[model samples]
Target: MNKSNFLIVALVVILGAVLSSVFIVDEREKVLVLRFGAVKSVKDEPGLAFKLPWPDTVVRYDDRILSLDVEPLEVTPLDDRRLVVDAFARYRISDVEQFREATGAGGEQAIAVASRRLDSILRSQTREVLGSVSSNDILSSDRAALMLRIRNGAIQNARAVGLEVIDVRLKRTDLPTDNLGATFERMRAEREREATDERARGNEAAQRVRAQADRTVVELTSEARREAEVVRGEADAERNAIFAESYGRDVEFFEFYRSLNAYRSALQAGNSSMVLSPDSDFFNYLKSSGGISAQ
Candidate 1:
């Protein structure tokens, strides 16, 4: 080969070697330099990185936060209530060397393996933490506290796989279909008991009011009857006194007046027939023109 051609080929080989040795690390990724299947160095910052060509290799891990949705799982709480729970988790790669070692793969393959491990950890922790509490706690605002416990537990287990758990959350919680009917029946029975107690109390109050009203009516009616009897006695006494005064003034005229009154009373009935002697004193006023008795 000519010297010029040999020089050109040498430059080309050098340029290819330089290009192959250079790599990029972005803000979202963490990189590891492995020497013959052994981790040699880690690069986390965003910049250019370099390594030997051929024998040295680079592996990447996503440093950004990642999400995983857990499938619905059945859990039995302290109260023995069976609940179906759906949950999710947020995480990130915190240790690249450990991650690569644990997964035995890099990049997308490592991510897939890590995700499965994370999901399993979350499921185990969820079951453990939630099972220690009652269903009421699971359904209440205190659920935030429970989720924290779950996250902490998952973080401890996930360190082996180089994962840092950010947070764990329960997306949905519900009674299992097998327990729903019984739960609803119990709730219905409780409400019915409350309603029955309320009705009984209302009926009792009504009876009390009615009794008081009846007592008030009886007292008022008795007082009214007593007053009427007293008024009637006073009126009778006054009328008798007037009659006595009239008799003292003129005996004959008083007797004639009384006779006229008796005749009016006896004859006032419509279509009434009297069977009495013609000399009856009751007829004295009718027989005499001057209203005097004809005895």
Candidate 2:
């Protein structure tokens, strides 16, 4: 052989030896080695490894967290409403053998297959299982529990297909396109109705309170009027009695006292200017009636 040909052969042998002896796995990955179309061994750790290159195939997969996003699906709610749900899942490969055997003996292809299965699982679960439960329960208390149950259920199904589901979670569940606007309108109407009812009740209570206060005021005013009437009647009766007693004591003096009192009260009440003859009847009381007076 020529020198150049000899060098080429040596290079080919060296390259083959290097290829046959070398295997590498990342820290976040695991691998399965297949020799002659049969799985020879599984590598769960990281770093360099040695294997026969010609007949052995190294299958690498992520050992760390893996995530899968599910496309949105249309769902019919218990209330007969349509909703679109989109979700995701985080998982890790639990068994290397099952993963290799079921998912085409490798991580990349195996995850793809597992994703399809997980999708089916999610769809079926949301429809048949989650649908039967109350919407309030799902929205309120059991959301986490529901997710966990779905995760466990997915894990169980994944195991059959050589996949291990670490977790499953819901990202969003929303009203479908046509129903979104209607749902918002209905929710707004319901809240507005509630607000209106609350306001009406508050107004009713305020009216009742005002009416009660008005009634109390009226009652107190009537009571005060009644008391005032009683006092006035008693005062009038006492004044009349006093006049009667004075009149009974001396008839002429009583008449003189009454006439003088009337004159004093009438004259002092307003501006008065009076001109009268002393001998007139208006001044008769002060006149001397020693002989006889006219009737």
Candidate 3:
């Protein structure tokens, strides 16, 4: 080859080698430098990273948390009730060296392999943990506690694949389609029975209140009437005593006052008139300005 051509070829080869030797590690990624398919160095921090060119290759795996959706699994709880559960897990690549060895794959392929392995672990653990509990526990407010147990179990198993399991959660747990109608009917019946009981209790309370109010009204009215009768009796006794005292003081004057009151009552302004003889005793006071003897 000519000197000029040889120089150009050397420059091209040098440029290629420099470009291949250096790579950037993003903040969200972890890198592995492999020599002949064996791990040589790990770059976990962001910035420039170097490796020998040609035979050496760089493989990157995401360092950020990742989510894996598990396939729906059917579990029979301790109550022997079957449920279809959908779950997911959060994980991150914690140990890249071990991950490489466990997955036996590089780059994005490692993530796929790791996911499959971790999925198996999560499924097995999920079934084992959930199977020991009752369906009520799985479906109630105790779900947070059950999820924690699931996460703990998954952690131990996921470590084998160099993944740190952050959490395991049940997205949904549902009765089988065949059981839905029956379950809903039972729930409706239970709610209606409870409502009936509440209404019965309310009616009983209202009756008690009404009866108490009625008794109170009767007692108050009777008490008020008794007090009024007592006052009237006292007034009658006082009036009779007063009449006796006035009769003892002056007999004629008492008779004259009583006759005057009689005249006022019998001659009140109304469509009422009395027919009497002119010599009647009632006219004695009118005949003479004095009394009956004077007439």
Candidate 4:
């Protein structure tokens, strides 16, 4: 090779070596320098880092918050009710050396292993903390407190695996499929009983109102009948007194007036016929100008 060509190849080789030895650690990552498969140093802060070009490597781990969703599992609470629970966890790698030692793998593989470990820890802790509480408590507004306890427990247990459990949350808590039907039936029966009670109360109120109205009607009718009878009795007494006074004033005139009224009543009848002598008292008014001929 020519002199200039040889210098150009050597420069390229030197550039490759320099580039291979240099690595970058960003704000989102924690880098580990492993020499011969053993972690030699850890770079937690964001900056430029270096490692030997040959037989040395750099492994980057995401230092930011990570999320892992646990599959739905069944748990029995203190109330002895079976519930289906789904949980998720937020975590971050806290100790890089410990993390590397635990997984013995780098990059995505290590993250996957750590995630599996974290999921297991969270599931166990979830069961432990949730099982101590009643199902209603787990589903109540106080669930936030229960979640905090589970997170704390998970953090404690995960420390051995180099994970920092930031938070643990229950995504959903539901009754098991086998129990849902029975629960719905119980709810329906309870509602039906309440409805029945309301209807019975309404019917009772209606009956009371009807009975009171009937009683009021009977009382008003009875009172009206009594007043009518009193008025009728007073009218009869007044009529009898007037008749006696008229008789005392003129006995002959009263008899004549009564005889005229009787004759008029007998003659006014439709197609009426009477058999009587011409000189009979019944015809006195018709036979003479003055009834009874003033006898």
- Clashes counted in candidate 3 amount to 0
The TM-scores of all predictions, comma-separated, are: 0.64, 0.56, 0.61, 0.61
**Which candidate wins on TM-score?**
1
Clashing pairs in 3: none
Error of 2 at 150 (Å): 7.4
Model 1 spans with C-alpha error above 4 angstroms: 186-295
- Per-residue lDDT of candidate 1, residues 1-295 (tens digit): 9999999999999999999999999989999999999998999989999999889999888899999999899998897878899999999989888888788878898788888999999999999999999888998866889999999999999998899999999999998888799988876887899999999999999999999999999999999999999999999999999999999999999988887677677677593588999888777777777665443
* Residue lDDT tens for model 2, 182-237: 97887798789999999999999999999999999999999999999999999999
Better of 2 and 3 by TM-score: 3
Name the lDDT of candidate 1: 0.90
Candidate 1 clashing pairs, residues 3+ apart or interchain:
none
lDDT of each: 0.90, 0.76, 0.89, 0.87
Candidate 4 lDDT over 1-295, as tens digits, reads 9999999999999999999988889999999888888888888888888888998988888888999999898888886778899999889999988877777767888789988898788888888998998888987866889999999888888998788999888899998898999867866887899999999999999999999999999999999999999999999999989989999998878888788688678787574687878778776667777556554
Best by lDDT: 1
